[model samples]
Target: MLSRLRDRPWTTALLIACVAQLLFLWGLGRPGKLSFDEVHYVPAARTLLALAYPANTEHPLVAKAFIAAGIALFGDTPWGWRIFGTLAGTATVLGVFACLQLLFRRTPVSAFGAGLAMLNQTLLIEARTAMLEVYLGAFTTLAIAALLWSMRGRPALRLTLSAVLFGLAVGVKWAAIPYVAGAGLLLIWGKSDQRDYWPGLSLFPALALFGLVSVGTYLATFAPAFFYAQDPLTLSRLIPFQVEMYQRQTQILAPHPYQSSWWSWPLLIRPIWYFYEPDNGVQRGVLLLGNPAIMWGGLVAVAACLWAGWRRRSRALLGVGLLWVGSLAVWAVIPKSLGFYYYYHLSSIWLCLALAAAFHAYAKGRFARANEWFALPVLMLFVYFYPIISAAPLSGPQAFNRWMWLDSWR
Candidate 1:
């Protein structure tokens, strides 16, 4: 099985992603209640479906609309509320595969990156719940792939498609705007006759068209949210609505139990728990945590990429790191009180890619077995933490405590 899979790395990576999604879906509806953001987004979805303005105007509707679509098909069960998230999670994994393929052109390394994406506990946790971040993450990751594809010869179509996805990603979460920034940098670098990969597309016109299409796609996403109300009128009301949203976001200065500063995020100092049913009989909970081996290992790997990229003058390393840095850095500018652990998703996405690069580079060095050995501990961490991450019933407080590495986790 291993030999056969080694010959077809993309197929293997996709299978792993699918298996993870299937596992997420198999017992997905358990605990049977809305978890964290689900409590907010699911009702908002119902509102959209009913032709009423949703309560949380702070967030855009693209992701909620998806949850609404899921609910429409699945009939308002827990499965209904969270089903799209599973699909989004699967999409994120595929995005990682496509991206690695473009960047490294190595099927095994790309496959390993996809595996790293699946291994991130927070990514999996967000997938099992109804949250905007998963959709944002998935769409942005795919848009990154599209942008890379656009770097090839006569890539106007791919660039346009990438713009559309980036626009959709923005509509999912305003946070995804950073992806557009990353794309812009990539497009700018891909300019001219000294092309490394493909015969470059017309530079200026293509960039202008890319912006136009991106804006068009973004506005199109908001189009559906407006039709239900005619008297208040959608387009005219949008500016005021966004102004109000910005006001609300800024006013989130009060402390939150689960909130953490952006600085604490990369260190894995705090994690958020989205749901819990800690009854006297059985204690079940879902914690938004990472596989420590991968999370910490990723940090080291990314740092190594810093040195390696600088030494090799590696464009891929620098570009991938830029996404991670910019995403996380922007959060520092946002209200510190409003920041939380889940915001780490953006950085984590790129970190997975960097980790794969590390594994690839390490394997090529004298310590050829290092990367494989590293996977052993990562796999062990995933299995050991599965119960808590999935809300499976625990043995007792002791069992729960065993998983709790710090006070903030409580």
Candidate 2:
């Protein structure tokens, strides 16, 4: 069984990603009203679909463009707009799985990472919505996977292609900036410092290639207005639109009904209920929360990542640190005007990576052999608590009854 599993075909990885995505899309089920940030982006996407580029937005039209694509395909239903996000999410799983294959050179770990992602409801929930973050994340993962694959002497064509994907990621969401920076650092390490590293001829060209692509793509969003505008008011609308978008990002959010700090996120201390109602005589809603087992277990794993980075400076540990530091940096320094739990999507990817690294370290069996067994119980506990977190259909106070260990989860 082990041998057969290890030797599973590469197609199986793609299949796993596809199946997971299909399941999530199916669960999305209906075209409900705009929930959460949908209110902001959906209208903008409608504007974009009509070819009137809205101004003052911090992000490029890539995500809205994607939403537009769904509209074009299926005609402006909620499911139609969100299908793109679901597809992006699947692509992300494949990218991460491929990256694991490249980094660790083991099919099992690659399979494991993708498999775990398939089962992770948090990632699924986010992916099944018309959100830009998942789109950004997918492109970022793909770019990273391409970069890592290039390290193995794959193809120069891939190197240039990866740059375009990185540009797309930045165009989708600015959160991916840190991961892009990390890729540049990896090149520096491979070229100048590492002992066994072979400095490839394409490395410098690749960096310059990606740099130009990212900058040029970002600037291109403005070109339509600059070149094709019919009147001065067209220009006027563009500038303020861009400024408000930028200001909204940096503005410190005031305390609101459901605001949460960054510190409370990882603990799953307070989950935001995305939809809640008793109008139909029952509570039907969706709770935006993290996987408790993964979230809490990741705390220990992240600490291990820090220790490993400090002591041996292992490539894996260093990768984890870069991911963690970069993902959390904006939240740490930026003044908060509007804050919510979903912002953790960027940082949460690191939690997945950190846990994977910890499991990889222990998989060598040098540490306590019993740790592997512990994963079973942890997995069970995560499954047990999922219904409440999802708010599937729990009656009256039973819905809030999972307040057993984590009182703050209430």
Candidate 3:
């Protein structure tokens, strides 16, 4: 049974996703109130359900739409607000597992990577709350996984699916634009060396076709917003609304307590406190810190991937390194004056890929078993930090002091 399961990557991926969903769902309504940006998004979702003029126009509508769906199904409670995010978070874990399987064809390595992703704290907190980042992360990660799966066979269908997923990602957040561009560049690179890479079409035409499909899908997500009974958005106003969104995104905002720069993200310098409050006699908190073992260790692994990929011309390693760098690099150039560690949500999953790739590279070495055991520290740290990250009741107000090893984290 074990051997058969190992041979089937999707089965392993599904199993990992199921476990991740349970973790995400556990104590999901602990705070029993909106946490962090849920204050903004949950209300927007409610307004969306009312079919009123769109709220939260700064972001595209798809994520709020999903949130609205959750509310409609589960009622206007914390569980209803966050259930879909939990599911999306589970989808992200599944996508990470599938991507690793496609890149390395090793079920153990892929499952290990997915496990690290679930324990990566950022995903945990975001998944349990009503937020856009996890939804955006799920769509973009799945799109990348689909692109990789397409490389093996059945290009037309999978590639089209990839485009649609990318579009949905953009509809969740414009942050996906760079990733969409990265996917196109990967396709172009694939065509240069591999025959029939994109089937019959030449480079530019294939790019154009995917681009159109993605844009069309992005526009389609606004269908709900367009039908508002009051101040309904019209086709004529669509492009102008996008321009307004860009301006809103770029305008400098008042400084936030937890904001950090893109360069500081991988270092885990400053993490956002999504929810920190008293519940009865105990203090409950939810911090967006990454698993330190994975965060710092994955950097070394990513460097190893880049060096080995360049030396051996391995597309998988190079793609992992490039996508991680590309995702982080966009934040540096975007006009948003303020940034938060949570913005690194998309790039964090790639660290799982880097670690998996690095482990796969060393599978035959004397320390191969030791490499596999690396997940132990990752899991241990996750448990150690679970109380604060999960909004579990801490012993006292200063209970967070134990976890605040770094001064910057405070």
List the global CA lDDT of all models: 0.80, 0.68, 0.88
Q: Model 3: residues >4 Å from true position, as ranges?
A: 194-196
Candidate 3 all-Cα RMSD: 1.3
My TM-score estimates for the predictions, one after another, are 0.94, 0.85, 0.97
Candidate numbers, best TM-score first, in rank order: 3, 1, 2
In candidate 2, list every pair of residues with a backbone clash.
Answer: 55-241, 55-242, 56-241, 56-242, 252-336, 252-337, 253-336, 253-337, 253-338
After superposition on all CA atoms, what RMSD does each candidate show versus the true structure?
A: 2.2, 3.6, 1.3
Q: Per-residue lDDT tens digits of candidate 1, residues 275-375? A: 77764357778888888887788888887777777788887776666666777888877653478889898788788898888776656757776777888
> Which candidate number maximizes lDDT?
3
lDDT of 3: 0.88
Candidate 2 lDDT by residue in tens digits, 1-410: 65765777476686777687776676463325566677777787877666564443656678887887888898777777788888888887887688777777667667666765554556766776677878887888889888877676744556666767887887787766666677777766776765523345445775676677666665455544443233323555765755666777777655776787877777777776666554245555566666666677777878887777678768767677567666776677655566677878756666666666667765564554434564565567556755544335557645565544555544
Error of 1 at 392 (Å): 0.4
Ranking by lDDT: 3, 1, 2
lDDT minimum window of 10 residues, candidate 2: 224-233
Report residue 180 deviation for candidate 1 (angstroms): 0.7
